[model samples]
Target: MLVSVKELHQQTNLGDVHKEKPKKFDHLILGPAAGEGLPDRLQCQGIKALNKIHFGMSRNNSRSIDPVAFVTVFTIYNSTVESRPVDLVTVGNISYNKVKRSLAILNVFINFIQVNMPQSKVIILTDPASELPLQKDMVTIKPIQGEYSRDKLMLQRIRSYIAFLETRLEKLSQKQEQFTHFIFTDSDIAVIDDLGQIFIDYPNFDLALTFRNNKEQPLNSGFIAVRGTAEGIQRGKAFLQEVLKVYSSKFMKASRMLGDQLALAWVVRSNPNFNVRRFSRREAFLDKIGGASVLFLPCSSYNWTPPEGAGQFHGMPLDVKVVHFKGSRKRLMLESWNFFSSSSDLSDTLCLILKSGRTKYDF
Candidate 1:
């Protein structure tokens, strides 16, 4: 029952859908479409807008993907127009600027992954009805009805994350034949290298999450690589459920504006015994976590965060692997996007920008 965007539009005829078949996209690191029965719930809440801008062009059109890939990457996208309502300050004559910025970032992020990680299949589970042509080895699924109320946007986001984990795990359980491991990341990510090793690196660990600023901020749930295991599967479900409990508690509600990070921190604290390991390139994590002698990754390249409490235009690091551009720094998002967009040398797009040869373009 897993169909491409065209199939869903033709069959359901849901909200403002384009009946015309989407042009095949040209992807960076090419692979075939995933034929496994991955369900996409097409609400079609916001496809009309995505089409007008031609947000993500047919970047991967020149390439083809192999369906029987071993690695799968999962990410989610829920916009204000499609998922919830937010009042963002926009400058100049641009309308829906935040939404536009998000779409732009997603385009770059997907292309980066495709260019770097050629062997992986990426599935973007979004509630918005988007028409970004499928990047080679990429599929967009409308997993479940996203929370639409603006009364409590933060709470709604928490609910969406909970449902996201539930649906993805269930679908992955059914389609076990298509993948060996899965990496879940946020849409704001701009990856700079091939992440094929991330899937198989820690076979015993159930989940491998990225972190930053060990002394100030303990962790970030932005990028999580989870091993699909039936035995400890229940624990994963329970962890998400517990996150809801913590997020909905009196303390959380009483706080000004609670976010997913707080809930993730709660999960990490509550499940210290769980087989969850940290991945970051910097030595700070090792220094903070009692210098665990185990061979840990310098994940700074992937989960790079800008310096906090700094003045505007703090700029990105020279060796940052993935510039996250966190939510609080929405203003910096467009800047980060611009820096990568015009820079002529994306690591994956051209074979000329090979990992060993390209000069590090720092912000």
Candidate 2:
């Protein structure tokens, strides 16, 4: 039987259950709720109301988004306070297509958090007037100010926005007392299991960084965990900004394939506070390979690319930990989406994409 929200709370929380229903939230976002089901009628109404209020409160030049694109929700009850511990944050640009995929990704992430990390609070930071709302344990905070250019530059907008996240995060470092650790993950990525064990078990690691094959190159920038110390945060922010600038410039000038991964590596290499560590690449991929799940994801598997069997190592086991289905390559996604078993909801999500390629969001 599928678990209800209340059952989720009961199964996970290690604290007293009598705590008032979390009305006042720590953060919010325009994403899916923690469930296997889609949004209900009441949930849809809530989203519409939240959007109306968000837009109504906007300035004359504010941007608006479809209410269905971004669902507003509260805390995910799966993550246990004792198991997965840390402050959660997400960074991404708001686009019609991206918003839809992001909502789907958010659903998986929320459920992951609910089942694994209960104590952590998730906050989403995005462009100003981005139309996110405050939920139970989740809050939405717009950065102070930033510019998103629309020039005919490849990956420029994405890199610039990532740079924006870095700048904003640095400012947040000044107020370290407010949080213990800050995590920045891409909306395209989803958490397949509990992350607290990785953090709690390991020592002498300041930051948890994701990279491609340990070729001393950065290929994936989907997941990042930064220490809360002033210097640590500064280092993390600087790493992200510099890497984004360099990598973005490369992609813009050459129109080459080097994407978020190389840029992420640049950031880590440049940042003094970073202690980059590699994890299982297979574990990160969404497709089930061998029995073991993919965890330390490679860049090729995480980005938007056509489904060619070239990336998969046939000899390996079939356990996909996280999957990054970037919306850029619809055709490739369609081909690969069919490979997964019907058990993987991603196949259905992929079918949705294939049916409506390049037509903007529809999840």
Q: How many clashes does the backbone of model 1 have?
A: 18
Error of 1 at 117 (Å): 2.0
Tens-place lDDT digits, model 1, residues 1-363:
113445534644655446765332211111122211222211111111101111111233213322212221222334335423343334223333345555555665666666545555566554454344445445444444555344354455445555655665676688845433455576666565444444334444445555544533345656655455543233445654665677677335533344556765655555445333342224423121111111233444456544331111222223344555554444344333343456544422111111111111111
After TM-score superposition, the amount by which residue 272's alpha carbon in candidate 2 deviates from its true location, in angstroms, is 15
Tens-place lDDT digits, model 2, residues 116-228: 34545565544453444334454344443333232322244344344544654666665533535555565544333334443333423444554444554445544555555
Runs in model 2 with CA error above 4 Å?
1-108, 133-136, 149-179, 214-218, 248-251, 254-259, 265-311, 315-320, 328-363
Ten consecutive residues with minimal summed lDDT in candidate 2?
65-74
